[model samples]
Target: MVTEASETNRDAGSVGDVAARIERLPISKWHIKVRIVLGMATFFDAFDALSLAYVLPVLIPLWTFTPAEIGLLISSGFAGQLVGALFFGWLAERFGRRPAVIACILVFSIMSLACAFAWNYSSLFVMRIVQGVGLGGEVPIAMTLINEICATKGRGRFVVLFELVFPIGLVAAALFGWWIVPTMGWQAMFVIGALPGLVCLVLHRFIPESPRWLANKGRRAQAVAALDAIEREVAGAGQTLPEISPMKVGADRHASFKDMFGPIYLRRTLVVWLLWFGTYLCNYSLTAWMPSIYRSIFHLPLEVSLRYSLITSIFGVIGGLACALTVDVFGRRKLFSFALLWSAVALLSLWWTGATSAETVLIGVTVSYLGITVLSNGLYLYTPELYPTRVRALAVSSATGWLRLASIIGPTAVGYIVAAGELKNVFLVFALVAALAGLVVMLFGTETKSRLLEDVSP
Candidate 1:
């Protein structure tokens, strides 16, 4: 295995020796390929995560599910997600990031398709839980890989690039749902959701095992080979090569289950968990219940309401990309705080406009979606960076599990609000949550700007 020790030996040769050998590996091509793989996996993450919302606009009426039952179905995925995150984090530690990620995507994809075939409410609910597990695992693990691979100088760019697709995927799903739900029905929308994952599965084969994992595992030969591959790809177009330093490979890996609770990481764990929980609470509330909210308030046709929802979703994608572009330079802490403040304002505005005309409400909804997306997409970029490579998957998963727990709370709260005709109160409460999330992040979260992945850990 390639350990830090092995790197010293590789560096012992004339500095030129490391440079020549490392230059032989293909870095640019592989980087692009890996980024594509991560993005594609996120596509499934995007689809499965939000697909429930699209269905809610249809399923509630078709099946005559009560508000409480509909809330249950929406949140069931998050419960499964919590389990998947912790388990996959452990599994990634036991096996490897590549295997865990691929397995999670495949499982979720199949289960999402299974949702299409669900014969009753119970069956659908069960499949959603199973599907949630897979959804939970894929993103954090993929993020672990991406964070490990990119240079510290370029890490923010890469992480942002990694997150940009999530909004796009949701927007796509919304557009498709709007088009198909009326004609082909909700079932076909889910079947279509399954297709992207299959494509991702086929593409996933090309993604290599994470070099960081290999180095940590003491697989020196494979680790060196992987690094060499990345170097060569980067050296394309006749760029001058830099010396590569090899790390030692033969020690026992430092990552352990207990490391998650280590003194160095414990505080980080709490902050990230809170951030995930609070942000997700606001996000899922607007998402799972928004279409219905629009329908009730605006009295629009089903298809038209869905179309409005889809347009707002596209703005979210825009917000995500904008945040990604500036996060590193502007700083994660600043962006997160700024986004949260806006999210709070937007949510409150949404509540205030509840009684207004359809046009005014539509504008409020768009602003609300924009704020929430900026808050979420901006902050999630920080989750994997909080821990070292060894425990990164675990840390990220732990945080994500909290997010699922929030999902359980957020939608259930929406049900209560709706039942009591207190949807406006729900928005105000979520706005406060959004503001608190921002405060926690601004005060507690460390700025990862201009630091190597390993450097940021301690």
Candidate 2:
């Protein structure tokens, strides 16, 4: 009992030492470089994810696909993503984050090139799932890295700024698709999407592995060394270093997978899973289905279909930016509740219109997306905050598995619903989902604003 008590105290001290070291560091040029390097990975993931939505406008007419085939085509990539999220979550925990990140980048980058050469429906289908293994793994791992690095004071804004790269990538896809698909053909986007892989070559040069991760794993020497390097970089950038004082942490700081599924974490797991499922179900359905909806349902020209979709993308990005700026001020729970309820209202408005014309659907979808887009990106910031370092990546990645499931179900449901000529009913279903998510969050979600990660989860 004496030896065990002493060991527990030592473990508690180690966790505090690492958290204090990181929390003292200020925002510097080195941090920006780290964000830039990781930001490119997600920028292209978004670009690649959105690329399929744009490509489908051409493929629907060229390949002559039915509703089921189109839905499966959209869903196939998500199936691979679900695999990537689970596998890499385990990989990041078992191995290290840097290795898992580099491997996923290479996999997706190479597979993206394979997608470019796809000869037919079956060929592209296989390539996308394989490519998705990379795309799905990148963002969650990236989020875990950024969250681990940031000081507690600026974490929300800092992480969300990095996440904003994702929506910007979506906008870039829309912007580039307007010009490129009309001129260079559908193959060009895949070629462009693969370019973020080049970032993998220089990743190790810019950022070090997380000190918190090393500390939690009981590699105290390595964790201190990593923190020392960051301090030197901050000092080199002409910023004064604050004195390190160890924080007080809960004994639960050292965690395992079984502990994660234990009663302590079960409620957190369920709440975030609901947030993940509701947010993405509305988000991907609106984005992936819109171009095809404009082209097929209304018989719009291809350029016009993309242009209308672009308008909504711009509005959605506005919502994303607004959410990032205000999260710290408004608090995570309130902001999440507001965005979910707001979207529920916008989507329900479409249901009230009774199967409207194309322009009306466009307006309602854009309004609905404006709110849902906030949750879509902000979850990257919120999910990581709710877990300790040992299982942070695993937990975030697992929560995002619901996102993969939602993406698959959302678009496929839209496909079947549209095919059945129950177009407005899609908005009704999305509204109910959004509203339910809001109520759960408002009632059960913990407020994590301005707390150290160790304090929030521990």
Candidate 3:
């Protein structure tokens, strides 16, 4: 077995030897292939995560869903995601990234299928919660694995480019709702989400476990085998791989959850929590309710509401792409902080405008989406960079778990805030949150541009 062979080489290899090998390899077809496969899986993950937003507009009329019930349905998945993120993060650490990811994919896909078969709101809600577990787990593990494999020089671009697929998934969901819900039904969306199950086979067959992760686990041979597989592909393509760097060996320290608050990581951990909480709080608060807001408040037709929401999501994808293009160049701290502040200003503008006209609302949403999407996508790049490989996935997942808490509170608050008929309050509240997030980043965030993961975190 690979594990047995790795045990034999454990004493022969120094710490970070495998990471150095991985970091030194130039980008090649093998890297592109892995990104494509992972990107496809993420596309569906995004699709399933936001599919409920579109589905709810249709379900509201059919099931007579009240605002409170709507909040529960929207938050149920995030509640599951909180559990899944922590559980799967631990599984990634304990078992392996490859197995944990595949398990999460299967769990969500099967539960998504069950969602299609749901006979009532309660049934669908339960399925969404289960599906949320898979949705929550896959992302942090995927980011951690990508971070492990990527070169530092362009790490932000690589990770953010992969994350771009998520907003694309949102756009796809909006389009699906625009076209499908009025004709076929809401259940069809879940059926499409279930198709990602097929991606599980491709992932299992092709995606290698993170060499950094293997090396961290003291499975040196397995780590080398993984790196060698990529090196062989690079070499076969007639490109000479770079020589591995001489890595400084450090004590093999196992990270615990308690270490998250230790001096080295405490401020970083707090900044990330604020970032995740604020970003998702603003994002889901606006997005999860947009379709319904358009239909209920603005008195637009269902098709028009979905289409307007689609336009806002298109802006989000554009913003995410802009961030991916510039994050490495602008640096993580400056770009993230600036984007958050920009979003806060946009939300404040919306609040001042009274959010009275569709034109005013659309413009506000477009600008806010642009900034928030950048922060939303950028957080994935930023979070894992804060921790060493020993606790990378766990820290990222745990930090992101704050997003689930915000998700629950944000949408539920929207229910009450919108219920009060003072929609402007939502903008004011989110604006303050975004402003505070920007301040936190400016005050405490570390710049990770062009630095090796080990150097930045360790």
Candidate 4:
């Protein structure tokens, strides 16, 4: 009994020590190395996730697809992502971040390959849903791992820089669609999507399991070992680490789905849910439908439609990069609210103009894309900061599961709205949603800038 009690106290002490050590460590080459490897994996993830949008334009003409069928095909991956996010999130919480991330990478990569061989719309749709599972699971786990490893002072910039690859991936996909899809066919896009599987080997070789997660799980020895490895690298780089402030250690407990809805986390849970849903609803409604709209409504050639869509995606990448640069400077709440408000105004403008000319529509879509991209990508940095380490992956995953939900509904709604010849109403609805999202964040969201994760959420 005496030995057990002493061991427990030591473990508790180690938990607090872990966070302090991580926060005090100077940003080093090791940190950049980790981000680079992880960012590569995420880049491919973005490539695969949005590759379907580009493919849909090709598939529609080849298969003679109806708008509703097109919506279903677009939504299939999101449906899979919803399941993947929740399942992998639980896996990360119960198992570890490393294995969960690797497995998700493998699953998505293989499924992306399978997408290439799909003979019909049904087969392609099924493959997309399965691919989405891996794609959906990767983000929350990746973000959670990055969040735990980063210091509070530069956390926003670090994570956002890491996330910037996602838009880069989208831009790459758009360029591929503009060039490759027209030349080599849509199967080539899936071939590119499957390439990320190679990243799993690199991740397995370099990335360590999050030390904070190990400490929270009471595996103090391993946590110390991981931290020591990172510290040695920082030391080897000739940067002296700052002294770690002693923190009060609490009893370590296992986190559960129930914990997400507990009183302390409930408001954050709801706010992030609204944020994810509203942002994705607005985002995918425009992006997923743009190339299709250009093709069918404007009667543009496939290459020209893709080129226009690519321009909008480039604007999105620009917006995401801008947010990454400014998030640490201006803070999360203010930027998030402003982005949504901007999106709302842009969407309202599009609705008022009635998409009369291709030029008018492109300008409106570009502005809205810019605003929505900031909010959508910035959520990656913001959401994980709102939860404690124990439930951090789960909360982020669950919240993003709402994004998947929006991904599903938004496209399907666009299908019907476009079918009814009321496409302007789509903008009006998304505008209201964006306006509401801005208000919710302004009213209820907490600021996490420069605050330690433990202090912010605990």
Model 2, 96-210: lDDT tens digits are 7888898888888888888889889999999999998888888999999999999989788888889989988998898888779989999998899899889888997776888
Give the whole-model CA lDDT for all candidates, comma-separated.
0.75, 0.86, 0.87, 0.88
lDDT of 1 by residue, 325-351 (tens): 888779888888878778788778877
Q: Write the per-residue lDDT of candidate 3 for residues 42-72, one digit (tens) a residue.
A: 8999899899999888889888988888888
| Candidate 1 Cα misplacement greater than 4 A, ranges | 1-27, 200-204, 236-239, 245-253, 352-358
What stretches of model 2 exceed 4 Å from their correct place?
A: 1-13, 251-254
Per-candidate TM-score against the hidden true structure: 0.90, 0.96, 0.96, 0.96
Poorest stretch of ten by lDDT in candidate 1: 11-20
Residue 174 CA displacement from its true place in model 4, Å: 0.4
Q: Evaluate model 2: give its lDDT.
A: 0.86
* Clash counts for all predictions: 27, 0, 0, 0
In lDDT terms, how accurate is model 3?
Answer: 0.87
Clash count, candidate 4: 0
lDDT of candidate 2 at residue 391, scale 0 to 100? 93
What does candidate 2 score on TM?
A: 0.96
RMSD in Å for candidate 2, one decimal? 4.0
